[model samples]
Target: MFADARKIAELAWPVLIGQLAIIAFGVIDTAMVGRYSAVDLAALGLGSSIYISVYIGLTGILTALQPIAAQLHGARRYSEIGEEVRQSLWLALALMTIGFLILYFPGPVLRLARVPAALHERTLAYLQILAFGLPASLVFRVYSSLTNALGQPRLVMILQIGALLLKFPLNTWLIFGGLGVPALGGPGCALASITINWTLAIVGMLLLTKLDVFRELAIFSHFCWPVWRRQAAQLRLGIPMGLSYLIEVTSYTFMALFIARFGTTTLAGHQIAGNVGAVLYMTPLSIGIAASTLVAQALGAHRHEAARTLSRHGILMAVLIACCYALMLLVLRPLIIEGYTPNLQVAAAAMPLVLIVAFYHVFDSLQVTTAFVLRAYKVAVVPTVIYAVALWGVGLGGGYLLGFDVGGAIPVWLTGARGFWVANTASLAIAGFGLLIYWRGVSKRYLQVDAVGQVR
Candidate 1:
C-alpha cells in the first residue's frame, strides 16, 4: 500500500505542476487582456470558448495515444510506441486542418449562436488568428503524451514552463505594439499563442530526441504502411475514449454558449469562474493522469491487484485535494473573484457560481480519475457511454430545462450551469463504485482458479 501510494504521488506531482502552469498561462492572458480594455477582455472570453472547444475536443481524441503508448512501453514493445506516435501525429494534423478550415470561416456558425452583434467582428478576427495555432498545438500534444508515457514527465514540465514564460512577453509585444511591432490588440494574443505553440513543439521534439528511451524507438523513421495498421489498432481502441472526452467537454462548451445568450457580462463572469475551476481542477486532473499511467503499466505487467490498489490510492488523494480547494474557495471567494475582474456587477454575479464550482470539482475529480482507470484497462467504450448519458441526459437537459425554460433570468441561467456538474458527480460516483465491484469480481475469479489448482 505504501509503495503504491508513493508511486502515485511521484507521478502526480510533476503532472500537477505542469497542469497548473498551463492554467497560469490562460489566467495571465485573461489578466493582461482585462487590463488592456473591457471590450478586448470580452472578445477574448468569447473567442477562447471557441478556441478551447476545438482544441480540447481534438486533443481529447488524441488522448488515447498516451495510455496506448504507455501500455506498449510497459510490455517492452518500444518499436510499436514510435509507430503509435507517428499515427497520432498524422491524426492530429488531419484534425487540426479540419478545425482551422472551419474556424477560418466561422461566420455562419457564430451567427447561429445568437451572440451580440457588437462583439461579432472582433470575436471572428480573434478566432481566425487563433486557428493558426491548432496544427502546432496538436503536434505538441502528441509529443507531450509520448514523452510522458516513456516515464519522463519532468521533461514535459520543463518544456511547458518554457512556453508559459514566453507567452506573457510575446503577447505583450504583439498586442500592444511594443518592440517595433504594430498594435494587434486582441488578435495579438492569438499570434503569441501560435508562436508559443510552435516553439514548444520544436523544443519538446529536440529534448525528446535526447532521451535514450525515445531514441531507441527511432520515431522519426519513415512512416510504414504496416506500422499504420498497428496505429489504427490503437485508434480503434482509443477513439471511443476520445469520443467520451468530447461528449463530456462538449457539454460544458455548449453550456458556455448557453450562458453567452445572457450578455457579455454574464459570459465574461462565467469565463472567470470556469477558468478558476479549471485551474483548481488540475490538481485532481494530474492525479488522474498519474492513475492512468500507473494503472496501465500495472495491467501490462499483469499485476491486477496492484492496478486496483493504485486506483484506490489515486481516488483518496483526489478527494483530499478537492476538499482543500473547496475550503479555500469558500474562505476566499471574494478575493478570488475580484482578483480577476474589478467590475462590481460581474464580481457579485460570479460569487455564487464560484461556490457552486467548488462542489462540482469533487465529482469532476472522481469522474476523470475513474475514467482514466478504465482507459488504463482499455475498457473505454463503457465509460464513454456512461459519460454521454450522464452529461447530456442529466446535466445538460436539466440545465436547459431549469435555466431557460423555467427561470428565464441570467442569474438563474447561471445557476443552472451547476446541473452539469451535479450529473457529472452522480455518474462518476456510480462508475467509480461499479469499477470497484468489477475489480473484486475479477480477483475472485482468479482466486478460484488458483484454489482449484492447489487442490489438484
Candidate 2:
C-alpha cells in the first residue's frame, strides 16, 4: 500500500502543482479585472465562461495521447511513440481549427450571455484574441500529455508554472494600461494568455530537441503527411471523451443560467460555491491523471494484476483525500466564504451551499478518478454515454425539477439554487458508482483469464 501510495504521490504532486498554476491564470484575470472596472469585470466573466467551455471540451479530446503513449512506452515500443504523437498533432491541428472558429465567431455564446450592447464588443474582442491562441494551447496540451505519459511529468509541471508566473505581471500591465500599452481590459487578459500559449508551445518544441528523455522518440523527425488510419484510431477514443466533457460542462452551465432567475445574490452565492469545488477538484483530477498513466503502463507491460491494483488504489486514495477535504471545508466554511466576498448577503447564501459542496466533493472525486482509470483501459464510449445520462438526465433534469419546484413538491430548502446543488451531488454519486462497477467488470476481463480460460 505504501509503495503504491508513494508512486501515486510522486506523480500526482507535480500534476497538481501544474494544474493549480495553470488555473491561476484565470484567477488572476478575475482578481485584476474586478479591480480594473466593473464593466470589464463583467466582460471578463462572460468571455471566460465561453472560452473555458470551448477549451475543456476540445482539450478533452486531445487527452487520448496520454494513455496511448504511456502504453507504448511501457511496452518499450519507442519507435512508434513518436508516430503516435505525430498523429495526435494532426488531430490537434484539426481540433484547433474548430476551436478557433467557435471562439472567433462566438455569436451563440454571446447571445446566451445576453450581454449589454456596451459590453458586447469587449466580450467579442476578448474571445477573438483568445481564438488566436487555440492552436498553441492544443499543441501544448499534446506536449504535456506526451511528456506525462513518458513518466516525465515534472518537465511539463515546470513549464506550466513558468507560464503562470508570467501571467501576473502581464495581466497587471495590460489590464491597467501601463508600460506604453493601452488598457485593453478584458481583451488584455486574452492577449496575455495568447502570448503565454505561444511561448509555452515554442519552448515545448525546443525541449523535445534538447531533452535527452524525449530525444529518443524522434517526435519531430520529418513531418509525415497525416495517416488517415492512425488519425481515425485517435478519433475513436477522442471524440467520445470530448462529448463527455461537453455534456458535463453544459450541465453546470445550464444550472447557472437557470439559477440566475432566483436573483443576483443567489447566483453570486452559487458561483462562489462552484469555484470552491473547482479548486478542490484539482487534487482528484491530478490523482486521476497519474493513476491513468500508471494503469496504462501496467496494462501495456501485461501486468494485469498491477493495473487492477493501481486502479483500486487510485480510487481509494482520491476518495480518502476528498473526505479529509470535505471535513476541512465544513469546519472552515465561514472563513472560506469570507475569503470570497465581504457582502453579508452573498456570504449568507454561500454558507449553506459550501456545506453542500463538502458532501458533493466525495462523489465528485470518485467519478473523476474512476473515469480516468477507464480511459487508461482505452474505454471511453460507454463512460461518455454514462456521463450524458447521469449528468444531463439526473443532474440537470433533477435540478430543474427541484430548483424550480416544477411539481410543487419541493420544500423551501430544496428550492432555488440549493436544490440544484443537491441534485448535482446525487448525480455525481450515481456516476461514481456506475463507473466503479464498470471498471471492476472490465478490469476482470483483462486480469482474470486469458482467451483459453487460464488465469492471466
Q: Which candidate gets the maximum lDDT versus the true structure?
A: 2
> Can you write out model 2's per-residue Cα lDDT over 302-397, one digit (the tens) per residue?
888899999999999999999999999999999999999999999999999999999999999999999999999999999998898899999999
- List the candidate 2 regions with Cα displacement exceeding 4 Å: 449-456
Q: Write the per-residue lDDT of candidate 1 for residues 1-456, one digit (tens) a residue.
A: 667667877888888888888888878888887887788888898888778777876777787888888888778788878878777877887788888987798887788867687778778988998788788888888887886676678878887888888988898898888777998778888889988988887887776577676787878766554456755766776678768767877877777778777678777777777887788778888888888898777766656666768877877778777888889999999999989899998887677678778877777777777777767777776677777777777667766665564655445433444444444445555555555555455545645655777799
TM-score of each: 0.86, 0.97
Report the number of backbone clashes for model 1.
0
- Given candidate 2, what's the lDDT at residue 103? 93
**Sliding window of 10 residues with minimal summed lDDT for model 2:** 447-456
lDDT of candidate 2? 0.91
Clashing pairs in 1: none
Question: What is the Cα-based lDDT of residue 428 in candidate 1?
Answer: 52
Taken over the whole model, the C-alpha lDDT of each candidate is 0.76, 0.91
What's the CA RMSD of model 1 in angstroms? 3.8
lDDT of 1: 0.76
